[model samples]
Target: MFSFRFSNGPAAALLTAAVLLTVPGCTGPGAGQAPATSGPASGGGSPAGTASPGPPGVFPVPAATLSIPQVVKDVEPSVVTITTQTGIGSGVIYRGDGSIVTDAHVVEDQQRQPFKSVRVQLADGTQTNASVIAIDDPTDVAVIKADRSNLPAARFSTATPEVGDLTVVIGTPLGLEDTVTSGIVSGLHRNMPPSREQPQGALDLIQTDAPISPGNSGGAVADATGAVIGLSEAYLPPSSGAVAIGFVTPSATVTNVADQLLKNGKASHAVLGLVPADLSPEIVQRFNLATTTGALVIQVSPAGPADTAGIRAGDIITSFAGQKITQVTDLLAALRKAQPGQQVDLTARRGTDTKTFTATLANTSNTG
Candidate 1:
């Protein structure tokens, strides 16, 4: 069995030695105590109504090369350390009114319940209380309103980061605040399938080698120009034979979800209303599938988008929109890029017959 763990807090006794991936946030009885482990686990501008100082990509990029020290100086003020009764994590100052952005899991208690209010520590060491505003579990993004204001909000980049772009991560890892690490964008559009350990299931993440660790969740992942491009989410532990492999939530998603949360106190996601699973060799042999690659429709929701489009359980999704669906993650990534109420074409195979259907995506609400 493949195992994944959340990179939260200092390394506690292994919840399960088999776990591989982890979200980097400290969660336990105390910030000093080792946090419990689990299996594998945006946006710029003045989000919606609240007007902040900086907008997305407002920072000026140096024409020649990026100065690491200068980048750190620009972004550190916008980064803050977040502590709850359970443990600590990191967050970014989202607006001048003290709206902070962080991973949903960061504010979740040991029981995975979100706290109504938590403690926030500014870069200058000023501590204040913050109330949970909204949380989008599917995307693992959350917004909290701090009791303080006149803060320097970090500039988020609207432009997609290239693979080789320089990346700097600033967060409180292992309860050490204001830690900074550097690396380059390793890849893009990386997807994580839904698992018991990480039900949220990330889509279209920015892969980086920025040494993300425990307590790094919700921290800033900035580009060469000091523009916030992503937030540290999870990392593959070195025991998994992985090195410098970490995943970040891209800025576009951060802003999109943050804006919705700020305006509506909820975020909407495009849902196809179907349960999908990866095809196994044994299942393929048993079913005599014509193609081995594709997401197997495990179950279809009645009256849901897939059901309405005539997609039934046992059909293998071969294509979504205009993209080939090699696996469930591909479909999820495609869905993430699509908007609710939008119509798209879907192709599937039943037995040896190929069929195509137009599906109107549905909306699902996630409120804090």
Candidate 2:
């Protein structure tokens, strides 16, 4: 069985030596632990040869493709090592004024609470204290403001890379600073289900063959032009019989969440006001579901959008906003694309009846 584990450090105790499948958040060195089995959950850039200024705080993509060494020289300065009380991880400078973006788990204490401040080590080995600006746990994105200034912010590409595109990962793995790895984009739109270890719920991630070890979380994954396209998030360990399979949080999400947190001190998510679960054979047999596939509405939040739309716990969500919902990940992905307060059509099957209802999505906030 293949298991997913977050590549952060101070490796945790091994739960089992057998083939275990679980996705735990990466922390410091030796922090590896068995992950819990879960079901599926849920760009950048500019054109070449343009002299125009890109988006604010973003660097325009270079016209020419860069070599691996060139890419490293371009991006390494923007990557930093983040050390919290519990563990160490990596981060990318997000702005010239010392704003750094990293995985939320990187700055969190052992109890998973965000620290008010942590230490940051820049590429040149300049160590400084950084205050936690905010954290959105659901998305696993966090922002911190270092005491220093005039940092080299990485140019983040908004364009989505195609499968087989070149990727280079730079981070501090296992406390070894300045680690670099290279690979190709293995897949796109990969969904990872929420687990106890990663409560960020279902995540839509970019799949790559880049080697991501512990302490690589929040590190930069740059493209051929040296423009960062994603942040290292998780990886399948060697014990899982998987090689070179890793996951990343796309730059689009990192920027979006960071922007929201910077603007409002919290990140907003479209909420349907219900708990969705995958429909199993047992559930189908018990509920006599009309279809064997779809998200099972196991719980409905009171006064939430779904509840207001008259959705019940026994309903099976078959579609959302005109998209077919084959499973919980589908529903979550659809929700990710939606904005709060937007009215959309949702279809569900209750017993032998299929019903469609219009729901105004609600907004939920996550803060540090």
Local distance difference test, per candidate? 0.76, 0.76
Clashes of 2: 26
All candidates' TM-scores? Answer: 0.86, 0.86
lDDT of 2 by residue, 168-269 (tens): 999987777999999999999887664445422436789999888777888999988888998888887776677778888988889988988888998887
Candidate 1, residues 92-120, lDDT tens digits: the string is 99899999999887887645557999999
Which residues of candidate 1, in runs, are more than 4 Å off? Answer: 1-3, 7-29, 35-66, 110-112, 366-368
Once fitted onto the true fold, the runs of candidate 2 whose alpha carbons sit more than 4 angstroms away are 6-24, 30-62, 366-368
